[model samples]
Target: MKPVTFRNRTWDVAANLHLPADFDPAQTYAALVCVHPGSSCKGQTAGIYAERLAAEGFVAIAFDASFQGESGGEPRYVEDPATRVEDVRCAVDYLMTLPYVDEARIGVLGVCAGGGYAVNAAMTEHRIRAVGTVVAANIGRLYRSYGAAAMLDNIGKQRTAEARGATPLITTWIPDSVEDRKAAGVEDVDLVEAVDYYRTPRGRNPCAPNRLRFTSLANVLAFDAFHLVEDLLVQPIQIVTGDVPGAFGSMQEGRDLYDRVKGEKDLFVIPGATHYDLYDRPEPVARAVGRLATFYRKHL
Candidate 1:
């Protein structure tokens, strides 16, 4: 994997480019942009999949979204859906600059909320030939689950305060620790597994600090990542999610996306895998990668 940087509007996006062991500069290869989960970074699950996909003979890139991780942006940790979708398009622009990349064979894969952003971007970004998602979560729907009206009111106050010179309000994606979660009476299986994967040594990375600007909720609440997907998402898509139900609702969201898309699509449900299991578990991830390799090979 080679560390690289590219321009995404005014920010510099950091990424890791993974290439096959026998990669030859003289040969053009199909490439994939691997988008990391929300509150996550390129060095985590996205990086893992990019590396594995490279081993499958595809050039893959895992990148840090602008305003998060090593990427450059102000008021750091903001999770605006519009910018997230645009980041995917910018990644494609960067890939097209490579002489060894086949611009016509580029595809995209996203995990967790990144999956939602990828789908949203691919709807209008025809440069992407195929779409793949793993444990996809629609951020807008997830936020609405917590009651959008009240959250929007709070966000309004927070934004007003920040505008008047108050420091940006910060919130964590999950509790600081398992003990904190238990103390808060949070027992959701998806949240529990998320803590295990993101806050622990199993998948933690300093770049993915797991914090978000509280005021960023306004955009997230108003944005629908899957809006107009039925009409605009014409690319072949492969949706992967665990069968186990959880508070995050990604399993249902995956089904919703699969049923709504009118184009060629396939749904793969890992029997016992939970939302976070497919993030890094060896067996589940391997199975997902194998399936994705086949899909991309056929489409891209």
Candidate 2:
């Protein structure tokens, strides 16, 4: 993996780029950007995906978000909706520079929050020819408020708060702990996995900076990855989720999102697979990666 400096809009983001062996500048190859889920960095699952994609002869990159991981931003771990979207755009900007790249064949792969960001990016950016998501958390309606009902009421409140010139109120991101999981009851749909993925060694990386912060809640609530989702369907989409009952029941999210799609799309549900399995398990990741390669081979 080759580490490089990447700029997202005004901010500089640190990213790792991987190219296949026997690569040549004279020949153009497809490119894919791998985005880790929120609270994660370029290592872990994104690293695995990047390596796999590189082996398959596609240029792949995994980057830290603007404020998190190794990237630079103020009030670290303080996330913002606008900047995150800009981060995605910036990633595409970086990919266009490589000698062996085919700009028209660029694609995106996002996991969890990264997945949501990828969806939001493709809807707005025309340069991305194809998009894929794994265990995606595209929850704008639930987050912007407090939960579901609060979001509805909070919209006007958030607007009023902004009008009043008060600092935005951010909710507490779920804690990273096994006990927290037990306390929260690990319901099928609640985003308990936030804590699970961010805290556990199964997904944790010490090199990825930032601890859980409360002040950035406004960004999570306000950022709607699927906003203008219907109008944003300019390219093909492929979503991967589990049929399991836990973690937002991504099965429903994937299905509903698929129904909303007006373009070419595919959805796969891993029987007996859980959300985390698709994140790193060898079999699950391999299956999704194969589908992704095939899909991109056809579309990108």
Candidate 3:
């Protein structure tokens, strides 16, 4: 894996480019852009998938979104859906400039909320030939489940305060630890697994601080990643989600996305796998990567 950087609007996106062991610069290869989950960095699950996909003979890139990780942006840790979508498009642009990359065979794979952003990007970014998602979580719909009305009101107040010179409010994506979540009476299986994967050594990375600007909720609440997908999303899509149900609702969202997509699509549910299991867990991730390799091979 080679560390790389590319321009995304005004920000610089830090990324890792994974290539096959026998990779030859003279040969063009199908490529994939691996998008990390919200509040996570490219060095985590996204890098894992990129490395695995590279071993499968594809050039894969796992990138840190602008305003997060090592990427350059102001008002750091803001999780704006529009910016995230544009990051994917910019990654595609970077791929197009590579001599060893087949621009016509480029695809995208996103995990967790990144999955939602990928689908949103592919809808209008016809340069992407195929779409793949793992444990897809639509940020807008997911936040709505947590009571959008109250959150929106709070965000409005926070934005007003920040405009008046108050320090920007910051919030962690999940509790500091599983024990903290349990003590707070939040025992959702998916959330627990999320805390485990993101906050602990199990999958934590120095670049992934797991924090977001509280006021950023304004855009997240209004954004709909799947909006107009039925009409604009014509690329072949392969969605993989765990069967385990939780507060995150990614399982149901994946099914909903499957039903709404008008073009050729396939949904694979990994039995006994929870939402976070697809993040770094070996067996489940292997299953997801296997399906994705086949899907991209056929489409891209």
What CA RMSD would candidate 2 show?
Answer: 3.7
Segments of candidate 2 deviating more than 4 angstroms: 142-172, 183-197
lDDT scores in order:
0.93, 0.77, 0.93
Per-residue CA lDDT of candidate 1, range 28-55, in tens?
9999999988899999999999999999
Angstrom error at residue 278, model 3: 0.7
Model 3 TM-score? 0.98
Global Cα lDDT for candidate 3:
0.93
Per-residue CA lDDT of model 3 for 157-243, tens digit only, reads 988998999999988999978788889887889888888998889998989987889988889999999999999999999999999
Per-model C-alpha RMSD: 0.8, 3.7, 0.9
lDDT string for model 2 (145-234, tens) is 347555546656765776699765544356557787678676544355556665676677875543644545545776677777888777
Off by over 4 Å in 3: none
As a whole number from 0 to 100, the lDDT of residue 35 in candidate 3 is 93
Give the Å shift of residue 97 in candidate 3.
0.7
The Cα RMSD of model 1 versus the native structure comes to 0.8
